[model samples]
Target: MHLYLVRHPRPIVAANTCYGSTDLEVTAEELALAHASLLPVLPKKAVLFSSPLRRCRELSASLAETLGCQAPTYDERLAEMHFGDWEMRSWDDIPRASVNAWSNDMVAYQPGGGESVLQVAQRVRAFRDELSGLNIEHAIVICHAGIIRLLAACEHGLSIPEMALYAAQKPHKIRYGELLVVDC
Candidate 1:
C-alpha cells in the first residue's frame, strides 16, 4: 500500500504552545494555501482518511471534493497525541522536571498526565494493520506530525519500544502541510 501522510496546515495558536489534541482550526488563508498546494499533486482517486481535528478535517473535506474521492473517514487514531493538562500551555512554561521525566522514560511516561509514546504508537499500529487489510493501492491520511512519524516507524518494522524512542527523539523535519509518501 502507498500511504500519503499529510501534516495539516498551521493552526491558529500562539507560538511555542503545546496544542496536542487541542482541536484548533487553521486560518482561512492557511487552509486555502494548503489545499491549493496539495490539489495538483494528489491522486484523483484513492481512499482518504483524516484526523477528526478541525485543522485536518477542513483540508480533507476540500481535498476530497477536488480529488473526486469520498469524504475522508475521520479516524480518531490519526489525531495528535493527547497532552492532557499540558494542552495549550506554552512549551517554555512546562517544568523542567516533567520534561526530564518524559525524556528519561519516553516509552512509558505519560507526559502531562496524557498518553505515553508507546500508547500513541500502539494506536497508530492498529490503524496501520486495519488499513493494510484493505489492500488498497493508494491512500491519503491527513494527520499531525507525531502520527506521521509513528506511521513511518511502523513502516520500517520497528519494535514498539524502538518506535516510542524514535518518535520522542527524532527531529521533526516535516513542515506543516507537507506530504510524506511511504510504501508499506
Candidate 2:
C-alpha cells in the first residue's frame, strides 16, 4: 500500500528551531491553510495516525474528519525526538560545543534529558513493526521532522550524517520512510 505520511503544518513559534516533542499548537491561519490546500487532495483510502503531540493530532484529526474515518490512533513511539533541555531553545543559542557534539554523534549523543538519533530510530523500527500488523493498508502518519528523519534512517540504515542532511531538507514534502512495496 502507498502510505501518505503527512507532516503537520508549522506551529506558532517564533523562529525555526528544533522543538522536538514540544507541545506547540498550530495557529488558526495555519490550520486554515491545511484545510484549504492539503485537505481537498488527501487520499481517500488513507487511515490516519498521529504522534500523540498536539501538532500532529491537529492535522490528523482534521484529515480523518474530512475522510469520514475514525479518529487517529496516536503512537508515542512516533513522537519527535525528546529535545530535553533544548526543547524550546534557539539553535544559535545552544553552545557551539554542544552543536558540534551532536554534529559528530547524532546517533549516540544525547543532550541533557533528551534522546539520541539511534534511540529514536529504534523506536521508529518498533513503530514500523506495529504498523505492519495494523488494520489499515495505507496510513497517513502526521508527525514531526525529527521522528520522520529517524524513520528514514531506520528503514535504509542511513548514517547519522545522512539523517542530519535529511532533516535539513525542505519541509512539508514527505521525506520517505519505509518503502511499503517494491515494484520489482
Candidate 3:
C-alpha cells in the first residue's frame, strides 16, 4: 500500500508555542493555499484520512474538494502527540529539566505529561498495519509532522528508538504542509 503522508499547513499560532494536540483554528486562506500546493503532487483519486484536529481536518476537506474523493476518515491514531499541561505554552517556558529529559531519551521521555515519541510511533505503526489489509491502492493521510516523520522512519525499517533519532536528523524532519510518501 502506498500512502501520501501530508503534514497540515502552517497553523496560525504564535511563535514558539507548544500546541501539540490543541485544537487550534486554521484560516481558510491557509487551507486554500495548501490545497493549491498539493493539487499538483496529489493523486487525482485516493482515500483520504486525517487527524481530527481542525488543522488537518480542514486541509483534508480542501483536498477532497479537488480530488472529489469520499469524505475523509478521521482517525485518532493520526493525532499529534498530546502535550498535556504544555499545550499552548511557549516552548521557552517549559521547564528546562523536562526539555533535557526529552532530549536525553526522546523515544522514552514523555515531556509535559505528554506521550513519548515511541508511544506516538506505536500508534502510527498500528495505523499502518490497519492500512495493509485495506483494499485500496493509494491513500492520503493528512496529519502532523511527528506522525509523518514516524511513518517515514518506519518505511525505512528504523526501530522505534532509531525512529526517534532518524526523525531528529535534519533531512528526516518534515515541514508543515509537506508531503512524505511511504509504502506500507
Candidate 4:
C-alpha cells in the first residue's frame, strides 16, 4: 500500500496555543493554496480519508472533488490527540508540573486530561491495520501532525507502546499542508 499522509492546512488559531482536536478551520487563502499545491502532486485515483476536524475535512473534500475521487471518509481515529481542557489554552498557561508529569510518563499520562499517547497509538494502529487489509494501491489521509508522526512510527514496525514513546519524544516538524509518502 502507498500511503500519502498530508498534514492539514494551517488553522486559524493563535500561536503557541494547544489545539489538538479543537476543530479549528483554515483560512480561505490557506485552503486554496493547499489544494492547488497538492492537486498536482497527488495521485488521481487514491482512496481519501481525513480527520473529522474542520481543517482536515475542508482540504480533503476539496482535493476529492478535484481528483474526482469519492468524498473523503471521515475518521475519528485520524483526528489529533484530544487535548481536553487544554484545547485552546496557551501552552505557557499550562502548569509546569503537569507538563513535567506528562514528559516523564508520555505513554500513560494524559496531558490535559485527554487521551494518552498509548491510547492514540492504539487507534492509529487499528487504522493502519484496516488499511493493510483493504490492500489498496494508494491512499490519501488528511490529518494532523501527531497522527502523521504516529503513523510513520507504525510503518517503521514499532510496537504500540514504542509508537507512543516515539511520538511523545520526537519533535514534530511537519509543516501545514505537507505531504509525506510511505510505501508498505
Candidate 5:
C-alpha cells in the first residue's frame, strides 16, 4: 500500500489558463528536472502510472527514459478534473459568480461538464481499492494536485482543509516517494 503521488511537470501554457485533461507539451527543462529529482528516488523496480493527460504522460516518460524502461501504463482515473467548458480557459473566462459558488461549495458545482470534488474522490476511492489488492511494493502515480488532495483526504482520513494545506506545501517527491510506516 505504498504510493508516490507525483504531480506532473510543468506545461507550456499561458499565464492564467487551466489545462486539466488537456494535451499539453512538457518543456525540456521540466523533463530534465524530473530526471534530476525523481528517477534516483525511485526503487530499482516500481509500478508507475500516470494521468492520461499529455503533460503527465510526458513527465512519466521522461522518468521512464532515465530508468531505461518504456513509460508505464496510463490510467484514466488519474486524469485531472474535467473542467468541461472551462478547459484551457482562464479563471476570468469562467463566470465570477460560478467561481464564487465553487469556492463556497465545490461539491455541488459541476460546471459545463466537469466533475465535483466528491465525484473525483469516489473515482479515486475505486482506484485505491484496486491498488489495495496489488502486490506492488512501490507505486508511483503522476497526476494532478486534485488527485493528491482527494487521496490525502479520503484514504488518509484528513479533512479537506488539511488536505489542501498538505497538497500546497508538499513537493513532487514526497518523503522521497518512500513507503510510509504507520503503527495503526
Candidate 6:
C-alpha cells in the first residue's frame, strides 16, 4: 500500500506558542498556496483522510473539491499529540522543570499533563493498522508533523524511545504543507 502523509499549512499563532491539538487557524492565502503546491502532486482519486483539527480539515476539504472526491474521512488517531496545559501557551512560559523532565524521558514523560510520545505512537500505529486493512492501493493523510514523524519511525522499525530521540534531532522532518510518501 502507498501512503501519502501531508502536514497542514503553517498556522496563525503567536510566536513560540506550544500548540498541539489546540484548534489553531490557518490563513486563507497560505492554505491556497498549500493547495496549489500539493494538488498536482497527489494521486488522483486517492482515499483521503485527515485530522479533524481546523488546520488539517481545511486542506482536506480543499483537496476534496479540487479532486472531485467526497469529503475526507477524519480519524481522531490522526490528530496531533495533545499538549494539555501546554496548548496555546508560550514555550518559554512552561515550567523549565517540566521541560527538563520530558527531555529526560521523552518516550514516557507526559508533558503538560498530556499524552507521552509512546501514547501518540500507539495511536498512530492503530491508524496504520486500520489503513493496512483497507483494500485500497493508495491513500492521502493530512495530519500533523508529530504524527507524520511517528509514522515514519514506525516504518523504520524504531522503538518509542528511539523515535523520541530521533524526533528531537529533526531527521526526516516534514515542513508545513509538505508531503511524505511511504510504502507499507
Best by TM-score: 4
Which candidate wins on lDDT? Answer: 4
RMSD of each: 0.8, 4.4, 1.7, 0.7, 4.5, 1.7
TM-score of decoy 1: 0.97
What are the models' TM-scores? 0.97, 0.81, 0.92, 0.98, 0.80, 0.93
Order of candidate numbers by lDDT, starting with the best: 4, 1, 6, 3, 2, 5
Query: Over the stretch 1-184, how does candidate 5's per-residue lDDT look in tens digits?
Result: 5677777777788879976767787788876776577766665456778788887887777676666655678888888777788888997888888777766665656655687666666677677667768877767777776776666555666654554444434554432112222211
Candidates in order have lDDT scores of 0.92, 0.68, 0.85, 0.94, 0.68, 0.88
Candidate 2, superposed: residue stretches over 4 Å from native: 154-184
Candidate 6 TM-score versus the reference: 0.93
Per-residue CA lDDT of candidate 2, range 61-174, in tens?
A: 877888886788899888988878988888888888988887776567886459876677767777866776775666777777666655555455555456544554425344
Worst 10 residues of 2 by lDDT: 175-184
Clashes of 4: 0
lDDT of 5 at 16: 93
Regions more than 4 Å wrong, model 1? none
* Model 1 lDDT tens row, 51-162: 9999999999999998999989999999999988989999899998998998899889998999998999999989998999997998999999999999999877788889
Question: How many clashes (backbone N, Cα, C below 3 Å) per candidate?
Answer: 0, 0, 0, 0, 0, 0
Candidate 1 residue 70 C-alpha distance from true site, Å: 0.6
Candidate 3 whole-model C-alpha lDDT, 0 to 1: 0.85
Q: What lDDT score is found at residue 27 in candidate 2? A: 84
Q: What would the per-residue lDDT of candidate 4 be over residues 1-184, giving only the tens digit for each residue? A: 8899999999999999999989898999999999988999999979999999999999999999999899899999999999879889999999999989988898999989999989999999999999999979989999999999999999878889999899889998999999999998
User: How far does residue 124 in candidate 4 sit from its true spot (Å)?
Assistant: 0.5
lDDT of 1: 0.92
Better of 3 and 4 by TM-score: 4
Task: Give the per-residue lDDT of model 3 (tens digit) for 1-184.
Answer: 7789999998999999999899888777878778888999888779999999999999998788789889999999999998778889999999988888788887777888888877888888888778877989899999998888777777777776787667755354567788888776
Better of 1 and 2 by lDDT: 1
The candidate with the higher TM-score, 4 or 6, is 4
Lowest-sum lDDT 10-residue window in model 4: 155-164
